[model samples]
Every structure is written in structure tokens, then in C-alpha cells.
Target: MVRDRLSWMRFCGLGIADTVPDANTLWDFREALIKADALDALFNELDRAINQAGFIPRAGQIVDASLIAAPRQRNSD
Candidate 1:
């Protein structure tokens, strides 16, 4: 999935010169966080901030969607 979204990721300043971090890098980062015992703390902080910001959904559904288009192929008669 990340490979397919490389352009969007680069646009967000995640990588440089058409090169994005591979799956190993992401896995290593997650492992380091787990070893440091910070994952729970991180989740707690995110939950607290979201609740404080009044983004809690109430009795309604939330949907996220995106659209991507591909170039048309040339036709040969």
C-alpha cells in the first residue's frame, strides 16, 4: 500500500528525490517504540488530544474517501 502511495507520501515531505522509506524502516521504528514502552503513552496522548478537540463522534457515522484517476490509453484503430 505504501509503495502505491509513494507520490502522495513524497508530497507530504516523507522522503526525498522519489525515494521513500521501505517496509523494514517502518517495522524497525515500531519495534524501537515498543522496546521503549512508549506505544501506550503515545496512544493515550492521541486519545486525550482528540477528546479535548471535540472530535468525538456521537450517534453518527464518519466516512473517509478519496478518488484517484489514471491516464487514458491511446487507441489504435
Candidate 2:
């Protein structure tokens, strides 16, 4: 799923995976966000590219489950 997002980001002209700033250090992470924010316009432009690519944003399937059942399962089990 992450791969899909990264691929989408690339398609939006944000950049290649390796070309993005290294996020090893706090400074790096901050810088990466700055770069991403600076490219926000480019990302928004993805609406056209995505449409051209035949992608329409729809709600994705629920992959993460809620934790409400966890306590009940533990107690019942």
C-alpha cells in the first residue's frame, strides 16, 4: 500500500523514492516536509494526472480494525 502511495507521489512529479530527502535525522524529516509542502501545488496538480491515468479517488477498504473488540475478546477468552 505504501508502494502505491509512493508510486502516486512519483506520478504527481514529487520525485523518485530515492530522490526524496533522507529522513534518518529529525532535521532530514523536517527538510523533507518542507520540500513536500513546497511542492504542494504540484501534488494538487495530480488531480489532472490522476484523471488522465484513469484513477478516481474513492474510499479504500477498511484495513485497520478498531480496538473496541480487543478488550471483549480478552475477557471472554
Candidate 3:
């Protein structure tokens, strides 16, 4: 999804030509953070900051399904 979605790429600060990490790489990184016991701390900090900024989490989700035109894929032999 990160590679296919421009919004995700932008959120990750990646350019169109940048290589996105594979699933295993992401999983390993998360495991390392968990081993260091930092994941919960990170989430707590994020929650605190968002709350301080007046953001509330509600039950439900909103998706923007805007149509976008993309270039055709070309296969090279």
C-alpha cells in the first residue's frame, strides 16, 4: 500500500523512486522496538501530544476515495 499509495509514500517521506522496505524489514524493526520496551512509550507520547492538541479518537473511519489518474505501467524485457 505504501508503494501504491502516494499519501503513504509522502507520509513516509519517500519519493517515487525510493525503495520501500519489505514487510519483514518492518516486522523486524517493530520487534526490535518491542524488545527495547519502547513501543508503548512511543504510543503514550503520541496519545498525549494528540490529546494536548485537541484531537479525539472516535469509533469509525473515514476514507478519501478520490479518483486520480496515473501513468500506465511499462514492462521491460
For residues 20-69, what per-residue lDDT tens digits would candidate 3 score against the true structure? Answer: 99999999999999999999999899889889989996648888999999
Q: How much lDDT does candidate 2 score? A: 0.62
Candidate 1 lDDT over 1-77, as tens digits, reads: 54577667765576545566688998998899999999899988978888998898454677668777889999899
- Tens-digit lDDT string for candidate 2 (1-77): 32347775675476554444333664775678687785566667877787898998765667776555434445553
The predictions' CA RMSDs to the true structure, in order, are 11.9, 9.5, 14.4
Assess every candidate by TM-score: 0.49, 0.32, 0.64
Each model's backbone clash number? 0, 0, 0
Which structure among the candidates has the greatest TM-score? 3
What lDDT does the true structure give each of the candidates?
0.77, 0.62, 0.93
**Candidate numbers sorted by TM-score from highest down:** 3, 1, 2
What is the alpha-carbon lDDT of model 3 when measured against the actual structure?
0.93
Which portions of model 1 show Cα errors greater than 4 Å? Answer: 2-19, 57-77
Best by lDDT: 3
